[model samples]
Target: MSQRIFHHPVLGSMEERTALQFQFNGAVYTAYEGETIAGALLAAGVRTLRVHEETGAPRGIYCNIGHCYECRVHVDGIPTVRACMTLVTEGMCVTAGSVLPTPLKKGGHAK
Candidate 1:
Protein backbone atom coordinates (compact mmCIF):
# COMPACT_ATOMS: atom_id res chain seq x y z
CA MET A 1 0.00 0.00 0.00
CA SER A 2 1.09 3.58 -0.56
CA GLN A 3 2.72 5.12 2.52
CA ARG A 4 1.51 8.61 1.80
CA ILE A 5 -1.79 10.43 1.84
CA PHE A 6 -0.92 13.04 -0.75
CA HIS A 7 -4.36 14.40 -1.49
CA HIS A 8 -7.08 13.49 0.91
CA PRO A 9 -10.50 13.92 -0.65
CA VAL A 10 -11.65 15.80 2.41
CA LEU A 11 -8.44 17.32 3.83
CA GLY A 12 -6.70 17.96 0.53
CA SER A 13 -2.88 18.11 0.52
CA MET A 14 -1.18 16.93 3.69
CA GLU A 15 1.58 18.97 5.20
CA GLU A 16 5.04 17.69 4.33
CA ARG A 17 7.42 16.66 7.08
CA THR A 18 10.67 14.82 7.72
CA ALA A 19 10.44 11.04 7.99
CA LEU A 20 12.02 8.77 10.58
CA GLN A 21 13.11 5.18 10.45
CA PHE A 22 11.97 2.43 12.82
CA GLN A 23 12.43 -1.30 12.87
CA PHE A 24 9.44 -3.63 12.86
CA ASN A 25 10.13 -7.34 13.19
CA GLY A 26 13.75 -6.46 12.44
CA ALA A 27 12.90 -4.70 9.17
CA VAL A 28 13.30 -0.97 8.81
CA TYR A 29 10.34 1.19 7.73
CA THR A 30 9.91 4.89 7.21
CA ALA A 31 7.55 6.77 9.52
CA TYR A 32 6.45 10.30 10.17
CA GLU A 33 7.25 11.87 13.51
CA GLY A 34 3.71 12.33 14.84
CA GLU A 35 2.18 9.12 13.52
CA THR A 36 1.36 6.30 15.90
CA ILE A 37 3.10 2.95 15.61
CA ALA A 38 -0.05 1.32 14.27
CA GLY A 39 -0.39 4.05 11.68
CA ALA A 40 3.18 3.57 10.57
CA LEU A 41 2.69 -0.16 10.25
CA LEU A 42 -0.49 0.32 8.29
CA ALA A 43 1.20 2.80 5.97
CA ALA A 44 3.86 0.23 5.27
CA GLY A 45 1.25 -2.38 4.45
CA VAL A 46 1.75 -4.51 7.54
CA ARG A 47 -1.68 -5.94 8.25
CA THR A 48 -0.74 -8.35 11.00
CA LEU A 49 1.15 -7.37 14.09
CA ARG A 50 0.75 -10.57 16.07
CA VAL A 51 -0.92 -13.94 16.49
CA HIS A 52 -3.07 -15.14 19.35
CA GLU A 53 -0.90 -16.67 22.08
CA GLU A 54 -3.08 -19.76 22.39
CA THR A 55 -5.30 -19.92 19.32
CA GLY A 56 -2.75 -18.57 16.82
CA ALA A 57 -5.30 -16.27 15.24
CA PRO A 58 -3.90 -13.16 13.58
CA ARG A 59 -4.50 -9.71 15.03
CA GLY A 60 -3.99 -6.14 13.91
CA ILE A 61 -4.96 -2.67 15.03
CA TYR A 62 -8.57 -2.35 16.15
CA CYS A 63 -10.50 0.45 17.80
CA ASN A 64 -7.48 2.75 17.10
CA ILE A 65 -8.02 3.92 20.65
CA GLY A 66 -6.27 2.33 23.64
CA HIS A 67 -9.18 0.37 25.08
CA CYS A 68 -9.14 -2.73 22.87
CA TYR A 69 -5.57 -3.93 23.56
CA GLU A 70 -5.70 -5.67 20.20
CA CYS A 71 -2.71 -3.76 18.86
CA ARG A 72 -0.33 -4.76 21.65
CA VAL A 73 3.32 -5.08 20.61
CA HIS A 74 6.78 -5.11 22.07
CA VAL A 75 8.66 -1.83 21.85
CA ASP A 76 12.40 -1.94 22.51
CA GLY A 77 12.04 -5.13 24.58
CA ILE A 78 9.02 -3.95 26.56
CA PRO A 79 5.97 -6.07 25.88
CA THR A 80 2.20 -5.38 25.98
CA VAL A 81 2.54 -1.80 24.77
CA ARG A 82 -0.45 -0.57 22.78
CA ALA A 83 0.82 0.36 19.32
CA CYS A 84 -2.15 2.59 18.60
CA MET A 85 -1.16 4.78 21.53
CA THR A 86 2.62 4.72 21.03
CA LEU A 87 4.22 7.12 18.58
CA VAL A 88 7.04 5.89 16.41
CA THR A 89 10.55 7.08 17.17
CA GLU A 90 13.67 6.96 15.08
CA GLY A 91 15.63 3.74 15.56
CA MET A 92 12.88 2.25 17.72
CA CYS A 93 12.66 -1.52 17.64
CA VAL A 94 9.21 -3.11 17.47
CA THR A 95 8.30 -6.78 17.66
CA ALA A 96 5.07 -8.57 17.00
CA GLY A 97 3.31 -9.80 20.14
CA SER A 98 3.40 -13.46 19.18
CA VAL A 99 7.18 -13.52 18.78
CA LEU A 100 8.00 -11.43 21.81
CA PRO A 101 10.30 -13.13 24.23
CA THR A 102 9.40 -13.49 27.87
CA PRO A 103 10.18 -10.28 29.69
CA LEU A 104 12.92 -10.35 32.25
CA LYS A 105 12.84 -9.04 35.76
CA LYS A 106 15.29 -6.50 37.05
CA GLY A 107 18.85 -7.83 37.58
CA GLY A 108 18.47 -10.18 34.58
CA HIS A 109 16.11 -12.87 35.82
CA ALA A 110 13.34 -13.92 33.46
CA LYS A 111 9.91 -12.86 34.62
Candidate 2:
Protein backbone atom coordinates (compact mmCIF):
# COMPACT_ATOMS: atom_id res chain seq x y z
CA MET A 1 0.00 0.00 0.00
CA SER A 2 1.32 3.42 -0.92
CA GLN A 3 1.11 6.36 1.46
CA ARG A 4 0.80 8.84 -1.35
CA ILE A 5 -2.19 11.14 -1.44
CA PHE A 6 -4.02 10.19 -4.59
CA HIS A 7 -6.82 12.69 -4.26
CA HIS A 8 -6.55 15.73 -2.10
CA PRO A 9 -9.65 17.53 -0.97
CA VAL A 10 -8.46 20.85 -2.26
CA LEU A 11 -5.56 19.97 -4.55
CA GLY A 12 -7.60 17.33 -6.38
CA SER A 13 -6.03 14.25 -7.95
CA MET A 14 -2.29 13.79 -8.21
CA GLU A 15 -0.73 14.14 -11.60
CA GLU A 16 0.73 11.16 -13.41
CA ARG A 17 4.53 11.29 -13.32
CA THR A 18 7.28 9.09 -14.56
CA ALA A 19 8.42 6.37 -12.18
CA LEU A 20 12.03 6.55 -11.09
CA GLN A 21 14.11 4.05 -9.18
CA PHE A 22 16.42 4.96 -6.32
CA GLN A 23 18.44 3.19 -3.68
CA PHE A 24 17.89 3.67 0.03
CA ASN A 25 20.06 1.92 2.54
CA GLY A 26 21.09 -0.52 -0.19
CA ALA A 27 17.50 -1.35 -1.17
CA VAL A 28 15.95 -0.25 -4.44
CA TYR A 29 12.65 1.63 -4.34
CA THR A 30 10.37 3.32 -6.80
CA ALA A 31 9.69 7.05 -6.76
CA TYR A 32 7.76 9.31 -9.03
CA GLU A 33 9.42 12.16 -10.83
CA GLY A 34 9.24 15.44 -8.90
CA GLU A 35 8.53 13.58 -5.65
CA THR A 36 10.65 14.24 -2.60
CA ILE A 37 12.86 11.48 -1.19
CA ALA A 38 10.94 11.46 2.05
CA GLY A 39 7.66 11.22 0.23
CA ALA A 40 8.83 8.30 -1.82
CA LEU A 41 10.23 6.51 1.20
CA LEU A 42 7.04 7.04 3.12
CA ALA A 43 5.03 5.76 0.21
CA ALA A 44 7.26 2.71 0.21
CA GLY A 45 6.41 2.16 3.93
CA VAL A 46 9.69 3.41 5.32
CA ARG A 47 9.16 5.57 8.37
CA THR A 48 12.50 5.88 10.10
CA LEU A 49 14.90 7.87 7.97
CA ARG A 50 17.70 8.03 10.52
CA VAL A 51 18.62 7.68 14.16
CA HIS A 52 19.48 10.25 16.75
CA GLU A 53 23.21 10.95 16.83
CA GLU A 54 23.41 10.89 20.61
CA THR A 55 20.67 8.53 21.78
CA GLY A 56 20.36 6.31 18.72
CA ALA A 57 16.59 6.72 18.81
CA PRO A 58 14.72 6.38 15.55
CA ARG A 59 13.94 9.58 13.72
CA GLY A 60 11.67 10.18 10.78
CA ILE A 61 9.96 13.10 9.10
CA TYR A 62 8.86 15.63 11.72
CA CYS A 63 8.31 19.01 10.14
CA ASN A 64 8.24 17.86 6.55
CA ILE A 65 8.58 21.43 5.29
CA GLY A 66 12.31 21.43 6.14
CA HIS A 67 11.99 23.24 9.46
CA CYS A 68 13.14 20.24 11.49
CA TYR A 69 16.30 18.30 10.63
CA GLU A 70 14.83 14.95 11.62
CA CYS A 71 14.48 13.87 8.00
CA ARG A 72 18.15 14.37 7.23
CA VAL A 73 19.80 11.56 5.21
CA HIS A 74 22.87 11.07 3.07
CA VAL A 75 22.16 11.66 -0.59
CA ASP A 76 24.65 10.76 -3.31
CA GLY A 77 27.61 10.87 -0.89
CA ILE A 78 26.50 14.22 0.53
CA PRO A 79 25.89 14.22 4.26
CA THR A 80 22.83 15.64 6.03
CA VAL A 81 20.62 16.20 3.03
CA ARG A 82 17.01 16.79 4.04
CA ALA A 83 14.93 14.00 2.53
CA CYS A 84 11.84 16.14 2.56
CA MET A 85 13.59 18.87 0.63
CA THR A 86 15.58 16.79 -1.84
CA LEU A 87 13.73 15.35 -4.81
CA VAL A 88 14.37 11.76 -5.78
CA THR A 89 16.12 11.09 -9.11
CA GLU A 90 16.69 7.89 -11.03
CA GLY A 91 19.62 5.85 -9.70
CA MET A 92 20.13 8.14 -6.72
CA CYS A 93 21.79 6.67 -3.68
CA VAL A 94 20.40 7.48 -0.22
CA THR A 95 21.91 6.31 3.02
CA ALA A 96 20.17 6.65 6.33
CA GLY A 97 22.05 8.58 9.00
CA SER A 98 23.41 6.64 11.96
CA VAL A 99 24.37 7.45 15.52
CA LEU A 100 27.86 8.74 16.19
CA PRO A 101 30.00 7.19 18.90
CA THR A 102 29.85 9.04 22.16
CA PRO A 103 32.93 10.43 23.80
CA LEU A 104 34.50 8.60 26.75
CA LYS A 105 33.54 9.50 30.29
CA LYS A 106 35.41 12.35 32.00
CA GLY A 107 37.59 10.01 34.08
CA GLY A 108 38.01 7.34 31.46
CA HIS A 109 41.17 6.90 29.44
CA ALA A 110 41.61 5.36 26.03
CA LYS A 111 43.67 2.23 25.71
Candidate 3:
Protein backbone atom coordinates (compact mmCIF):
# COMPACT_ATOMS: atom_id res chain seq x y z
CA MET A 1 0.00 0.00 0.00
CA SER A 2 0.98 3.61 -0.50
CA GLN A 3 1.94 6.11 2.23
CA ARG A 4 -1.43 7.74 1.67
CA ILE A 5 -2.76 5.56 4.47
CA PHE A 6 -2.35 8.43 6.90
CA HIS A 7 -3.03 12.10 6.39
CA HIS A 8 -5.56 13.07 9.02
CA PRO A 9 -3.50 12.01 12.06
CA VAL A 10 -5.09 9.59 14.45
CA LEU A 11 -2.86 9.89 17.55
CA GLY A 12 -3.06 13.64 17.88
CA SER A 13 -2.88 16.99 16.18
CA MET A 14 -0.04 17.36 13.70
CA GLU A 15 0.50 20.95 14.69
CA GLU A 16 1.41 19.98 18.21
CA ARG A 17 4.46 18.16 16.85
CA THR A 18 5.29 15.03 18.81
CA ALA A 19 5.48 13.76 15.25
CA LEU A 20 8.04 10.98 15.12
CA GLN A 21 9.62 10.32 11.77
CA PHE A 22 10.92 7.20 10.02
CA GLN A 23 11.31 5.67 6.59
CA PHE A 24 9.23 2.77 5.41
CA ASN A 25 9.59 1.33 1.90
CA GLY A 26 11.87 4.27 1.12
CA ALA A 27 9.18 6.78 1.97
CA VAL A 28 9.52 9.05 4.98
CA TYR A 29 6.63 8.94 7.45
CA THR A 30 5.65 10.74 10.62
CA ALA A 31 4.19 8.71 13.42
CA TYR A 32 3.90 9.57 17.13
CA GLU A 33 5.91 9.32 20.31
CA GLY A 34 5.38 6.53 22.86
CA GLU A 35 3.32 4.50 20.41
CA THR A 36 4.65 1.21 19.20
CA ILE A 37 5.85 1.15 15.58
CA ALA A 38 3.10 -1.31 14.89
CA GLY A 39 0.56 0.85 16.68
CA ALA A 40 1.63 3.88 14.72
CA LEU A 41 1.21 1.98 11.47
CA LEU A 42 -2.16 0.65 12.51
CA ALA A 43 -3.30 4.09 13.56
CA ALA A 44 -2.24 5.30 10.16
CA GLY A 45 -4.40 2.49 8.81
CA VAL A 46 -1.50 0.54 7.35
CA ARG A 47 -2.75 -2.86 6.23
CA THR A 48 0.08 -5.10 5.03
CA LEU A 49 2.88 -4.65 7.55
CA ARG A 50 5.54 -7.23 6.69
CA VAL A 51 6.75 -10.55 5.28
CA HIS A 52 7.56 -13.73 7.13
CA GLU A 53 11.25 -14.42 7.75
CA GLU A 54 11.08 -18.04 6.68
CA THR A 55 8.28 -18.12 4.11
CA GLY A 56 8.10 -14.60 2.71
CA ALA A 57 4.37 -14.70 3.26
CA PRO A 58 2.67 -11.30 3.40
CA ARG A 59 1.78 -10.41 6.97
CA GLY A 60 0.08 -7.58 8.80
CA ILE A 61 -0.91 -6.60 12.32
CA TYR A 62 -3.26 -9.31 13.45
CA CYS A 63 -4.83 -9.64 16.90
CA ASN A 64 -4.93 -5.93 17.61
CA ILE A 65 -5.35 -6.92 21.24
CA GLY A 66 -1.80 -8.35 21.17
CA HIS A 67 -2.10 -12.07 21.83
CA CYS A 68 -1.26 -13.44 18.38
CA TYR A 69 2.30 -13.77 17.13
CA GLU A 70 1.70 -12.24 13.70
CA CYS A 71 2.87 -8.78 14.70
CA ARG A 72 6.42 -9.90 15.44
CA VAL A 73 9.02 -7.58 13.85
CA HIS A 74 12.59 -6.41 14.18
CA VAL A 75 13.23 -3.26 16.19
CA ASP A 76 16.55 -1.48 15.83
CA GLY A 77 18.63 -4.67 15.52
CA ILE A 78 16.71 -7.03 17.76
CA PRO A 79 14.93 -10.10 16.43
CA THR A 80 11.66 -11.89 17.21
CA VAL A 81 10.25 -8.85 18.95
CA ARG A 82 6.53 -8.30 19.38
CA ALA A 83 5.94 -4.87 17.92
CA CYS A 84 2.57 -4.50 19.55
CA MET A 85 4.12 -4.76 22.98
CA THR A 86 6.96 -2.31 22.55
CA LEU A 87 6.82 1.46 22.79
CA VAL A 88 7.94 3.68 19.95
CA THR A 89 11.04 5.77 20.51
CA GLU A 90 11.92 8.99 18.79
CA GLY A 91 14.28 8.53 15.83
CA MET A 92 13.80 4.77 16.06
CA CYS A 93 14.18 2.91 12.79
CA VAL A 94 12.11 -0.24 12.80
CA THR A 95 12.21 -2.62 9.87
CA ALA A 96 9.69 -5.39 9.44
CA GLY A 97 11.98 -7.38 7.29
CA SER A 98 12.89 -10.88 8.45
CA VAL A 99 13.89 -12.97 11.40
CA LEU A 100 16.97 -15.17 11.12
CA PRO A 101 16.85 -18.45 9.24
CA THR A 102 14.89 -20.93 11.27
CA PRO A 103 15.88 -24.54 11.57
CA LEU A 104 14.39 -27.07 9.15
CA LYS A 105 10.84 -28.17 9.76
CA LYS A 106 9.92 -31.86 9.75
CA GLY A 107 11.55 -34.55 7.62
CA GLY A 108 14.80 -32.57 7.44
CA HIS A 109 13.18 -29.87 5.25
CA ALA A 110 11.24 -26.65 5.51
CA LYS A 111 7.48 -26.83 5.89
TM-score top scorer = 2
Name the candidate that leads on lDDT.
2
Residues 1-111, model 2: lDDT tens digits? 777888999999989889999999999999999999999999989999999986889999999999989999999999999999999999999999988987865578777
- Candidate 2: 10-residue stretch with minimal lDDT: 102-111
**Every candidate's lDDT:** 0.87, 0.93, 0.68
**For model 2, what is the error of residue 19's alpha carbon versus the real structure, in angstroms, after optimal superposition?**
0.5
Better of 2 and 3 by TM-score: 2
What is candidate 2's CA lDDT for residue 32?
Answer: 94
Give a tens-digit lDDT track for model 3, residues 15-78. Answer: 4437777755455566776667677777667766678777788898888667987877667778
| Clash list (residue pairs), candidate 2 | none
User: What residue pairs clash in candidate 3, if any at all?
Assistant: none
lDDT of 3 at 19: 71
Candidate 1 wrongly placed segments (more than 4 Å): 1-3, 99-111
Q: Compared to the true structure, candidate 2 yields what TM-score?
A: 0.88
Give the per-residue Cα lDDT of candidate 3 at 12.
50
